[model samples]
Target chain A: MATNTEITSRDSSAAERRGAGTAERRGNAGEPPIRPPVDIREDGEGITLCADMPGVSKDRLNLRVDGNTLVIEGTARLELAENEEALYADVRSSVYQRTFALSGELETGKIEATLKDGVLTVRIPKRLELRPRKIEVQAS
Target chain B: MFSIASSASDSLFDELWQLQQQVDELFGSWTSSSGGIRSLPRGSFPAVNIGHTPERVDVYLFAPGLDPKTLDISIQQNLLTVTGTREIPTEEQATYYRQERFSGEFRRVIALPEDIDPDRVHAKYRDGVVQIGVERREAARPRQIEIH
Candidate 1:
């Protein structure tokens, strides 16, 4: 379970959105972990969610919507083979994953995502009822 | 008779070689493990670069167009982990002539040296790149003492 501080902190900042709790268990002699940050912005119509995942190509990425939850997943292809040791390897290729729960007020079917210049953006539109509609008053 | 060989053929060969490399990459998934759960391979991982200075170790990652908020970084037991996910793109009533990019969850883990002091780690994000500065433990720093 995530702590309240963790939830709010994670939700509040661009760097905290992806809460990589692996540091808590680094004591284990296993592997280290990596978590990239994501940002979400909501406007009158919908919310724009952005993520940074480098080295992942269109063929390797996957997105799915299940019930009220949206899931994103991706894997980075190894540019160089194991036998070839790069003199300088500055990019880290790894798996990417994220999940967001949609409220009933949102129109799940209208959600859309796009990957441009290495950033993945998901736009989730709100339901008509949730949006502020112009109310017409009868002439008295 | 004209020369049988032409420059076009040479260029075609170059294109063929590039295409062959792409084809090879398509057949092979980015994943290194058979379990199919992990997004990528393990170890220091290749794409990221770590530089060591006299007082600190600098880690740099090449990531473009990624929102800083979606990134998560953790250092524990001399290991650093970065994890996050990318959503699939959707458009309404639009036809695509060509499309290629991967979207989904990803996790990257890097091993660290024992001389690092996690508490002193500082990170900066710029131009789609992440740079982390980890201060070295006192014992790890170079020291010169005068002979008595």
Candidate 2:
């Protein structure tokens, strides 16, 4: 079993406020963005990250690694029927953005990601040189 | 290749962010207290959106990574209930650094508008969102009054 360490250093900055002014507003252009919650765990092989981003499809999601920083972004669009009005709303359509600073121990070239059921999982493998190895002892 | 910046401003920004989150939570709990509907606990899993048309009412629940087959939706009287469970991958031995993703079973109950046609309801789960539509009673729909 791979025992992983949890990492919580990543910070998600709030996205722009679209239709946050009033409750009566009904439009898709000005909805505020939401920062989805995330969880990260590290094992002997690499790190795994999971984020909850509902209403986002595969085509609308973007994942990139810049230098030592990893970025995840998703855009969600919500459109109501012409005659429909919001009676009560706790969820809104908006962009989701999160960034994490990567450490030197990780292998930047071997990163992998997947999106399913509105959840995004990212795997960051460790460099072979950094992995622990056992050496045999020689007798004189 | 990371460069170090001023640490003072970073800490200040973090403090401000925390304060803003607290304020948002306070208001969220306040506005959702109306009617008999109970406000969700802070950081509740799977937030929801509810809307209505002249023909029917629509409820959208944001739940990603949930199996559609495992979801249980029921409507009784004027109450709409949604129940489901999400199992975490536990085969890998991991130490907690930060675990924010919600798992396990959860149920959300919503009070429907009056005069809803319980028999005329439909639900669909797609792209991590669950949409439930309940038709309004024919008598409850607004009709244009003609001047005689």
Candidate 3:
């Protein structure tokens, strides 16, 4: 969970910008944290967000939702023995941060998430009343 | 070994050397770089970082969502090759609005330095990271002198 409480929004960009949460970091860490690649799937029920964030462990992962904003922040770490010294690595920085704004139709409290093999999967289900329901028609 | 940069401003070789230096700074151990002016694919799966201590060469590969047992890491001659396939996690009937994650198969081969001893190699996968340690030959280890 992120307690820093910093939020920002971006609009009218080059591409079609949905009001979804923009990529922002809580604070400056070396090079700016990069936006990990994400896969978004939408069904009639709700939407699923899968983010590829390798080197991020469960202890270091911070996932929280503030109002309509969903924030995914994690610090990727390379664990080495006390005597080991790392000279070079390609994954430029160890910080990963991304945010997504949620629509009112989804249930924020019921979001289910799991971190496995470096991928973060978060499923947000639609509101119960908003979901497709069978309406009974009475004879007038 | 340091390369002498060509003074000719118009030489394409100079540009390649500069690019190599930049990559070296970023990736640390880019020991095998083809000089041809070809763009390295940005989506190379499981990006790796190579570093070394006095006793062993350490390689760390960042790849998430993997079945660790399926990954293959082998050493042939001086080249260390890692091969694996990544299956996209999604239902066939699911409607995808965005797919930016790299999926499918990937093979990453690293050229081990001459001083590394191929016989003493070790690898393990944990928490989405593949770590490898290759010991260096006895002669390659730095000898510290006792100050008289």
Candidate 4:
């Protein structure tokens, strides 16, 4: 029942709200307005993306580009102090999750993601057969 | 003489104390090492965020690259359990490369407060995130006192 424009507008508003607040206040439960900023630039035959996912370790993160949807899910387990009580009076955990729907031009199998200092950068190159090529005119 | 109201309050407190003791006894007798994994089979417990508002309790779970049909959720007593497994990616054409993704059985259990109405719980899954809203029972909701 929802139109695409309506959904996009809502997403934009949520993004704005996330941008307006402190990083901690950006996201809560049940909604995902806050996400690590990512820049996807087109290279000669591929795309390079850099995402800031602080506190996420290589063991806790997963990246999969299935079809046209790129799924990113991970856990950021905060170290509990030894002296602190087991029960939490405030937030119990921190989460870092994001999902992006990529365009058809993306080559899923060629994508590569690397985590460095909590930042995730993914490079996806187009298939050699998929890239556009200019044809030379046949000599008369 | 002690008022009847005071006696009733004392009885209620006693009941609550007994319930707490019973919960503690059951959980304590279990052989579960707290740090040991409680996952179902072949999946990992993704990150989750839980929030409590006055009227409702909200829970969000992050799990992608999973089939919704494979995911199972159940509420027994005050415990909410989510369990499922994801298929491992297998490719015959690609050369040797690094693989870093979880695929297996996973289970996550959350204890709900006594105030939550089990019958009023509603859940929805979208965009690989599961959201559950548990509404408080009517009797547990706060009402303004009327001035005589």
Candidate 5:
């Protein structure tokens, strides 16, 4: 949900990419979720978001947007044969999740998402009225 | 008197520096000269997980947004190295609000515990993760000997 603070700060550069949510819900499947690194950019049209999610496939990836809340979730599968024994381990969790309370100015219905090379790209265009427009100046 | 006091402080500082290094090592994974920077105290590109079996070692490296043709994996004795380059997609006239993904050449060299057969190494890249399986040295086998 968009709060007054979140709505007013939507124009700020920090809020633009903070498409990374402040209210985080983690710890599922026995381990804490890995907060996948994300990048956000804004143009005259809307916001473009890219999240790095290695080991995630198209089938395992799930992205949802609801009432200004954007959620990204995926599971990373690591194969270990029956005979293989673990010597060293680092990736403790297979789940990756992130939530973002989006600005009200965005057109959630027009969001486009694509997954490639284990990276997720989500494009949410701004509302037509909210987008920047050039104002023609009359002859002085 | 000042010169002698300064030398004493210098030695003390050296001892403190070594102690700090030891503490860092104890707290993190002593992977190499860089130590444990895998999203811990420090962050490293293409985070990796290594495991072993009776025959071979298994390695999984997580890195997204890379060209498959650029990946290179090499094994020399016990050292295994994976290197590649990730180029940022060109964005014209776009203003970035946040950039966190790593884009550039990345190299990870790990010294394994036992010698590995260089020819027995098998590596595959899929979905942005590289899986490396290396067979241990064939010469290492327990033998039974008769003793009087």
Candidate 6:
């Protein structure tokens, strides 16, 4: 199960709520914006973010980095047969939005992103100075 | 008459809520076969939405990043089972700070309120969601009679 901490932290912020509200208002009638579950990990190089964004294709997904925040938005496309009406619907079709706060150590300019099988993987490399380095000791 | 209808609807909602709780329990109590460790029961992943129309009942499973070939759907009596597995290629020498997406085999079984025609059941997976439609039995459908 995905941890709820990241979602809770972002959701409790007024700025994040405003961003979400703006996205919802731009969506189709009765459709609300959803925050896709995400997994963030740190490694020797930097951090990797994996987001589950099913039904969102390459063209429909958008990623932006502004200052210290990274914003992800995607629209899911679902097609239903003609003359079909939903009777019980737990899944609502809508846009996906999420934001992450990044530190200055990250090299935002070189961030790489890819989408496959509806999962989005983003690799944010660290600044050269932030990477751990080993110093050689002279033998006396 | 209005009171009777309202009460009937209330009962239906109650039944649905009970079923949801049962599903949560079933999925939560399972033991991991590989690790031999007990995993904490968490909220349902790949959440589902169930709806019914006069003609049939529709089930929508929200699962993304699933290969269509790996998905298995079976219906026996009033039970509907959906099974599938997801595999993510391991990154060489990459250590994770947090791992959340569910991987490995997963099976979910749901009980229907009425018997359905298996032959008429149709399922389609698109845009990361599986849509299953099961036709209600002839006897269960509403019927109209002519006055003599």
Candidate 5 C-alpha lDDT tens digits along B6-111: 9999999999888767643543443333443322323578887776666777888887778778998887777788889988875878899888898889888877
Order of all candidates by DockQ, from best down to worst? 3, 5, 2, 6, 1, 4
Return the lDDT, model 1, position A93.
29
DockQ list for all candidates: 0.10, 0.33, 0.40, 0.04, 0.37, 0.31
Residue A25 of model 6 has an lDDT of 26
Off by over 4 Å in 3: A1-29, A81-87, A133-140, B1-40
lDDT, residue A6, model 3: 21
Local accuracy of candidate 3 as per-residue lDDT tens digits, B1-148 = 1233444543687788888787666444443363112213445677776666778888898888888887989998768889898888677777998898888888887776688888999988766888898999999888998999
For residues A103-132, could you state the per-residue lDDT of candidate 5 as single tens digits? Answer: 989998778877777788888899999899
Evaluated on the second chain alone, the candidates' TM-scores are 0.62, 0.73, 0.72, 0.65, 0.66, 0.66
Tell me which residue pairs clash in candidate 4: B41-B105, B42-B104, B42-B105, B43-B104, B43-B105
Q: Candidate 5 DockQ category?
A: acceptable
- Candidate 3 residue-pair clash tally: 2
iRMS, all models: 12.5, 4.2, 3.9, 11.4, 4.3, 8.4
The per-residue C-alpha lDDT of model 5 at residue B38 equals 29
Per-residue lDDT tens digits for candidate 4, residues A5-118, read 111111223333333322333232333323555555564577666554544556555566545777665454333222222221122224555777777776776677776544
For candidate 4, the chain B TM-score comes to 0.65
TM of each candidate vs. truth: 0.39, 0.75, 0.75, 0.46, 0.73, 0.64
lDDT (Cα, 0-100) at A103 in candidate 5 = 96
B1-148 in candidate 1: lDDT tens per residue? 1344656677788898777565434323221322123224433222465556567766666656556688898999668788765455654433332233335666677666578898998776553456677787998788999999
Q: Evaluate residue A72 in candidate 2 and report its C-alpha lDDT on the 0 to 100 scale.
A: 77
lDDT of each: 0.55, 0.72, 0.71, 0.55, 0.71, 0.67
- What lDDT tens digits, residue by residue, belong to model 2 across residues A1-140? 11122222232321323223222234434445577888888887888888898766665666777778987777654444667766655764466778889999998777877777788888889998887677779997
Deviation in Å, model 2, residue A77 alpha carbon: 3.4
